[model samples]
Each structure stands twice: as structure tokens, then as C-alpha cells.
Target: MALTLALESSSSSRGEGGGDGHGSCRPRESMFEKVVTPSDVGKLNRLVVPKHLAEKHLPLPGAAARAGGTVLCFHDARGGEAAWRFRYSYWSSSQSYVMTKGWSRYVRDKRLAAGDTVSFYRDGARLFIDCRRIRRAGVVPAVPPRQPQQAFFFHNQQQAAVQPQQHLVVAPRVVVVDDEVEEARRRRCLRLFGVNLELELRAEPLLLDLQL
Candidate 1:
């Protein structure tokens, strides 16, 4: 493209016939004309459409007579262009302006969704439009670390260790004793009491003899 532009520039300069034999050349006019500038472009309007608009015609807001039943050209970032038709009509005592044809194709190609914004512009004598897609902000929760299956048992042990005194209470145990063992304990007690009584009676008789 640069080479093409350079060649066109050289050819236009040659066409001016620059030969006065005094190292002088006639001034030549620029072959390329200035097209639309950034300041010349302005956003005419913006529209936020719903999902249903993709299948149905898109309604535009403006003077119906100016845009009614007229063809507008759209240019994309890739320099590709497509022609779309604008239609205006009256329905039930109300006027409506819409893009009747070529709209569905543009929407499908761009994969537009609900909440997506579309803006129209007036550049020179041409109509141009651009789209801005709306995105939702989301947050993904963090997953907790997994514990082993035996964690429950270890958790109980940890609780017990934290309060050692609470786990130190001993439960009483029941024992069965034989009748022969009970009888032997009773006989031993009787023998010890019987010997003490006999000694006391003998000491009383000696005291009576000394008094006489």
C-alpha cells in the first residue's frame, strides 16, 4: 500500500511538467484529497437492545422522515462494508423507525447479546455504527482443603487430650465372692473377741481375793 501511494504521488508530480531549464518546477496540486477527519465524526445516538431484537427488527430513534426507507452503509474494523436498509412506518397511530433488512445478518455476525450497546455516527454524508459488548463481573469462591477419612477419630483424640482430667474418672467394678470366704472372715473375728473376754474374767477373781 505504501509503494502504491508513493507511485501515485510521483506520477501526479510528473504530470505537472516541471521543466523551465532554470532548476525551477511548477507547483502541483495534491492528488490525494483529505477525507473525513476525527473531529468531523460525532456519535449521533446510542442504543442498547435486548436478545429479542436479534430476531426482530431493530428500532431506531430519530426523525422518521430523515432515516425512513433509506439505505445506510456500515463499515467494520476490518474495512469490510455491508449495506443495511432503514424503514419507517406508522402502526396504530404511532410512528416507528426500524432497520427492516440486513440487520439480522449484522447481529448474528457480531454475536450481539442483551445489554450490548450500539452507536450510530454521522461521518460526512455517510452513516456508520459501532458496537460495545457488556460483560458481567463474577467472583469464584475458593475451595477448602480436603481432610482424610480418619480425621473424625483423630479429632476425638485431640479433644480428649485437651481436657485430661475429664477423662480420668474410673467406673466401679462388681465382684462375686464365694460363701466359704465369708464364713472364714466371721470365724476369725469371733476368736479374737473370745480370748479378750476370758482374760478379763480371770483378773476379776484375783482382785476379790486380795480385798478379803
Candidate 2:
């Protein structure tokens, strides 16, 4: 008596034993014979690089791009909602090349100075595209923007103005975990150790905006 067996083959090539007899479940994506060309690279930039003027430079005849000391004047992802400003001297010193095909939200709102650099990365023909500010746009925020230290001061004043939590003593007692085994496990998992622990942390939540 003979038993029949069924197998799933994912190899790109069709050969003996259904999969070159290698008995490997090749990645399905590899099996897909998608052809990549200059046009395809351009499409990737049009997709992930976000909608901008510089993306127009994609399909740049390469799979990727790399630029040195490119100033990130503003990036929706790189900077917070506010498009921060940077020192002109920093970028000027690099003498870097800027990508010109696309302009992201940063370029539009920050009104970056001409000579600002932004490099675009993509697939296929367009990999690294340079962006530069041929002209300034929008109202430049300030030579050096204000810091959150002001907010910290305001919060401190308001907090001080209000009466502090009344100091009170409570009877010390042991926590009972009669039927909370799972709860104990969750508490144990979430507990950060030593340096990871904080109580009413005084640390600022975000980075100092570096426009340099």
C-alpha cells in the first residue's frame, strides 16, 4: 500500500520534485518575479518619501542616495509640530548639496533659508535625491527659538500657588494578594529596575530642539 502526500512549494524556479527537491519553503515574496527598474524606484519615492516638491527628482537613475551633513531644517517626523530653525553657519560649513525635487511640511512651514539641504532616499532609479532651499519660504520662526524652560517655570508657579497635598500619616499594612496571582505577575513584569524607576520625574519629556 502507498500513501499520497501533498506539499506546498514556494521556490521561484520550477524544477524536479516540485522545489528542486530542496524541501525548502522559499519565501513567497522571493517567488514573486517582480521586476525593478528606474521607473519602479521613482514610484517608491512617490509612495514613502511623502508628498513633496523634491520627490519630483526621483527615478534619479539609482536605487538609493547618500548625502553628507545634510541639514534637516525641518521634518514633520524629525521635528515636533513646530518647524525648528537652525544655524546657517552649520550647513554653510558642510557645503553640502541639497535635494530639490520635493519640499516636505518642514520646508513649507519653517520657511527655511536658501542652501538648506534635504536628501531623499528611494528604490530603483531614484535612490538619493538632494534638496536645497533656492529661496526662503514662510515666516522664519526666530534666529533661536524659545525653550520649554518657560513652561516649566509657569507650571512651577501655578503649582506653588496651589496648596500642596496635605501631609498625612496612614497606618502601615501589608498588601494582601489572596487571589491575585495573575495581577502579581503583571505587576512584576511592568516594574522597571533601579535606573529605570522614577517617581514624579523632573526630567523633560522631549529633546532640546537642535537647529544646528
Candidate 3:
């Protein structure tokens, strides 16, 4: 395949060109799409292209091409060019073609994972790549049930000392918060015992203990 890549910089998806007053039409463009595999996003950091797709869309590997694979520039959906050039090469051991050298960073920046879909569109000299993330069920959590107000204990050492027989109690303050976050904060307060109360209450822990 003889591929020349360039940014379209235009909004037109379908366009016409090359007319010599004769009845002739340009060949239809081809698109390559594949599902992302674990190795594509894993430590291997390379994408495996099928033999047919590689032959039909990528540069054929020769002695010089084998030594150093051709660098292909692919554009993203937002018309952003990739920071690194992707190397396209043919592997003899597995008799497969693969994309390497910059693939790792591409997947990382795109946040692509296994089971996602990646596609390549070849329009004349321009090439575009897009990613579609896999959809998972139950990703959005259901709304939690409403609960009573949250309370944090303030251990008054002075009050406890004054009335050793009676347990010291402090008035509870109300704050609107998620149940899980509030429960975690309550348990943390119980463990710290006002040591870090200012984090949740936004006031001096010792001062609040004394005032209450």
C-alpha cells in the first residue's frame, strides 16, 4: 500500500475530485476496524493487524522496511495529530503485521482498554483513527436511599473530669453529605477522637471540644 497522510482541515466527509470530461469514477475508499485486545493495551504496547488488512492498507515490508518500519501519522477525531509516530511492520515469526513504537503512549493517552473498538479510515491521502470504549452494565450506580443527619462525637475532657460519674455529651451538628462519605468520616472521628476534627468540621477540634 502506498499511503500518504495529511490533515483534512475540512468538515466535508464526502467530496469529489479528478474529472477529465470523461465518464470515470474514483475507487471507493476502504476502512479497517478491529477490536482492541488485552495485549494491545498491555505491556506489549503494539496492535496486531490482520494479514488481509495489513496487505490492503499498510506498507508492504521489504528488506529496508523490515530493518526500520515505516512511520504512519494518524489523526484523531478532534483533528488532533498523534504526538508520536506509529511504526508499521511485518513480523515473520508469527507471520503477522503489527504496529509498534508509539502505540503504548497512544493507548495510554486515549485510555483504551481490552474489548474497545479501534477503527482506521483511509480517505485519499488522509488517515483517521477512532476509538470506541466497551460498554459495561451497571456502571452508573443507583441513587442511594435518604438517611438521617450525621453526628460526630466530641469528647470533652474537662467536662468528663468535672463529672467523672456522668458521661459527657455534646450537641450534634448537621451537615448534608453522602451516606458513605459521612459514615466513613464518622468512623474516622471515632478512631481519632477529635484529633483531626477540623478536617470535617472546619473548626479547631480542641476549641470545639472546650466550647461544647
- Maximum-lDDT candidate: 3
Q: Provide the lDDT at 106 for model 2.
A: 29
Give residue 205's error in model 1 in angstroms.
99
By summed lDDT, which 10 consecutive residues of candidate 1 come out lowest? 189-198
lDDT for 144 (candidate 3): 17
Cα error, candidate 1, residue 212 (Å): 99
Ranking of candidates on lDDT, top first: 3, 1, 2
For every model in order, what is the number of clashing pairs?
A: 0, 22, 0
Off by over 4 Å in 3: 1-30, 61-64, 81-84, 138-212
What would the per-residue lDDT of candidate 3 be over residues 142-167, giving only the tens digit for each residue? 22111111323234422333222223
Clashing pairs in 1: none
Cα lDDT of model 2 overall?
Answer: 0.25
Deviation of model 2 at 42, angstroms? 25
Model 2 lDDT per residue over 1-212, tens place: 21122344444655321233223222111111111122222222211222133234322222233322233332221212343332111122433223332332223332222223333322222122223222222332222222222211121222333111322221322111111222222221111110001112223331122222
Model 1 regions more than 4 Å off = 1-68, 81-93, 138-212
RMSD of each: 44.2, 22.0, 18.9
Better of 1 and 3 by TM-score: 3
